[model samples]
Target: MDFLTLLQLLDTTVRLATPLLLACLAGLYSERAGIFDIGLEGKMLAAAFFSAAFAYSTGSVWLGLLAGIGVSLVLSGIHGLASITFRGNQLISGLAITMLAGGMTVLIAQDWFKQGGRTPQLEGAARFEPITLPFAETLREVPFIGPLYYELISGHPILVYIAFALVPLTWWILFRTRFGLRLRAVGENPASVDTAGVSVVALRYSAVMICGVLCGLAGAYLATALQAGFVKDMTAGRGYIALAALIFAKWRPWYALWATLLFGLFQALELRPDLIQQVIGVKVQVQLLGALPYILTVVILAGFVGKAIPPRAGGEPYVKER
Candidate 1:
């Protein structure tokens, strides 16, 4: 691709990657705390529908975001209660939650909005407008930094910045802080953490809480920032893709960023159907581009990622005595 085309591709990559990054980090937090949450898709889908529904009704994106977070947190609580408190099977609980959301979001949307499983298109304050960073305009005339900043780095919604910022913060939280130490400890060996007076249940619940909020942001961004409104199955399989990225990155926060960006690049390729055809003399179907995440998931599952070991206690319901 040409330089301008490359820049455009990268810009789209950043936007597309933001949600994946958010969801990936969410999974990182949960799995790192010994929780295997397969319902990331569910929480995000529910949050997307609720955020768009509320935003359309209230004409406020902030309200929409809060609504999204609220629903996601509720789902997270259910997961926590089932797996951590009641000692239910984590995988089953997560799958049930996902199915519940898949049905409930569409059902509720149809009953309330009558838009065939979607809210009315959001507008004005209901949407997130891109914010131009400082000096973006002034630096537009400068050398390489100018176009790069103005076109690629600046003029994104605030959540984009937040998603990128969370990488360093997540690293710090997982590696630098005492709570982080305990969290990882619980994931690796809950008995040790419990022996040290830490509550394994509490740590896992906190991880779920953080996962919920991040997934909420990811979903909200899908409805209010990336698209104008929510659609049926809007999140698609991004939640699963995030899970795969978590595996691909070996649960490292910084690697999650790069992994999500790689997937986002595939998504960006969907927008330019002719570009790939021109480069390779073979046309690629835009719809098939969506399968990249699934392909990656399969590859990872098939042991291409042999060294990507998960937390020792992952997916096991922790019984304090056991």
Candidate 2:
């Protein structure tokens, strides 16, 4: 309604969008390489648990981040082995990874911490604190620019900036590099890529590994930066939302950022129900607001928004002789 209120909304949108943006990019990389990964949620969940556990034990967030990335990479490697090496069904393998992470995180958490699937509360160096920008204090008195800079952009943790910065980097990598060209070619036509003297399996494996690294960072941000420690299923379907976002963006990096931000805005509104009611001057149900992301996903899939064409070789195992 007002300028300050708008700034607060934008700030909340950025915070909520960070993980979604990360996970969406992860999915984009994997799917663009012809690997349909439904296990992004699982990887994030497992990484969050392990990162929190290690951070609490060692009192170092950096080590926790590395542990998270390591665990995620291991799971990604498993997916790669099952689907690429064994040539199994990619969807089933991804589902298995998700189920495995879901059960394993809780099981290990209870056994180690005895807190019913929650790690010990993190403090001090185990957590990420918001960094204040250089001119935040001095520019607080400025008009529209002041709140935009000081309130919305200046107070987030380091990972938030990294997540946003990744958009352009991803765009460049997917469009401007030789590897990017080969990766896209493989997804569209693995046989053609193979004929060109490139290893399809190797390229797909690399993409999945990058996905794992990004998902690991997303999980670490959730456990250490957004919250003090990991909770059971803290990801709470953000992975699925990110997948939907990937589809919504049609696998484009810049569009993925906008899509994640739109979903995040819905989430921010759900968190502040009164604000929605104020804006619309009508009573709004929180359940309806919460369901917005899933509804959008279904609509996009049903072609209400537009036709979404996936990579030609997506969800298919590449056979050299086939």
Candidate 3:
């Protein structure tokens, strides 16, 4: 393929990667604190539905974003309560959240809008629009750099920039701060943290709630920015894909970018079958292309891409001694 075509594919890759990046990072904070949450997908789906519902009702995208985050936070609290407060099974609690979000979104959409299982198409101010960068049009003819700046690097929603920018911030927060040290410590050995005069439950809850906020952004971006409205199961297993990415990256911040971007490329390729045909000289099945991400997930989880050892105390309930 040519350079411009390659740039176009990359543009799509960036767009598709944004939500995954957000959700993957969400998982990172939760798992890193010893709370094994598999409910990222549920939180995203619930957020997507509620955000769209609120935005359509209020005609304000900001309200919708807040609603999304609010719903995700509630779900995160539920996860925390089940696994932390009650010391229940973390996996079961998380899976229950996913199932709950899946059914609740559709049921509520049909009850509220009567559109089978989707919200009304968001319009005007209720939806996010692409913002052109300051120098994009001015530098459109300055050679390769101009087009690269204009087409690939510019004209995206604010959240796209936010998602990519979080990479460094995540690394900094996880490594450079006192809270980061405690969070990692809590995940590795909660007993030690407790002995050090720290409340392991508090740190784990904070991490899970942070996970909720990021997942909220992911869902809002999906319903308001990427698509015009919410549909049934719009997340389409992206939460699971993000979990796989978390494992693939061995739970590192910078590596999450590469892993999500790699999965995002598959998503982009799914939309650009013509590009695939050009490179391979044959039209490929859409189903086959769509399965690429899942295949990678299985491969990574099966220890194919090096053993991804999770946190030592992951998925274990911390029991304090008398």
Candidate 4:
């Protein structure tokens, strides 16, 4: 492949990787805290529509981003109330939230946007611009490395970098900080944490809220970074993929990133079916490529990679005795 062509491939890979990485981390945050976050897909979809609508209305992507996060927080809070406060089944509550968000987004879009469950397209200026550092720009002029720079980092949206940056940040927060310690403790055994004077309810609530924020960002990234607008059901089951990455990663942030990247590679492969066919010397149908990741997820999980241990007290609400 030519240098520029290689760079373009790499750039496209990063673009594809961004949303998955963000969603994986968002899943990591909630599941790590012992909350089953099956509703992530719904939460992201809701945020995507709201973010796109807000951006279209205010002509400001930043405002849209804020609105997206705000909406996700509200939805997640309702999830917390249902699952945590009412002791509702976590899986059921999450699924309900997902259904609610999906239907609500479409309903609102149809009612207000006048685009039939779609938002207006955004301007180029409204989306995030890729940052090109001076060194990278200079290197781009040098030939091979220039193309490599472009492929790897040159033209990605700001959130792409942030997603990569978050992996280590998540690891540090989960492993090194006191809050992380408490969060993990709660997940592992809220009753124990409660007996020790920590408020389990408070910790779980905070965890879900953080989940909301990250999922909101994931949604906004999908709408603003991956595409310039929103459509009905735009998440396309990526949220489920993110949850799979969490389970596959065994709840480690760095491992989650690796898992997400593998899925991203699968997606990149699907997007360019001809390349895979040429490399494999067989004609692989587009449908097969699309199904590959989920198939692999089931296979990997069944084999018990990383032992797939969930939090001991996951999905259980804590109620202290008076």
What is the alpha-carbon RMSD of candidate 1 to the true structure?
1.5
Quote the lDDT for 90 in model 2: 91
Q: For candidate 2, which ten residues in a row score worst on lDDT? A: 300-309
Off by over 4 Å in 2: none
In model 2, the clashing pairs are: none
State the weakest 10-residue window (summed lDDT) of model 4: 1-10
| Candidates' C-alpha lDDT | 0.93, 0.93, 0.94, 0.83
Off by over 4 Å in 4: 1-6, 304-306
Residue 301 of model 1, lDDT score: 63
Predicted candidate 3 versus true structure: per-residue lDDT over 1-322, tens digit per residue: 9989999999999999999999999999999999998999999999999999999999999899999999999999999999999999999999999999999999999999999999999998898788899989999999999999999999998889999999999999999999999999999999999999999999999999999999999999999999999999999999998998898888999999999999899899998899989998999898987887777767777887777789999999999999
* Order of the predicted models by TM-score, top scorer first: 2, 3, 1, 4
lDDT of 2 at 12: 92
Q: Which lDDT tens digits does candidate 1 get at residues 170-283?
A: 999999999999999989999999999988988999999999999999999999999999999999888888898888888999999999999899888988878889789898
lDDT ranking from best candidate downward: 3, 2, 1, 4
RMSD list, candidates in order: 1.5, 1.0, 1.3, 1.7
Q: List the residue pairs that clash in candidate 1.
A: none
Alpha carbon lDDT of residue 86, candidate 4?
93
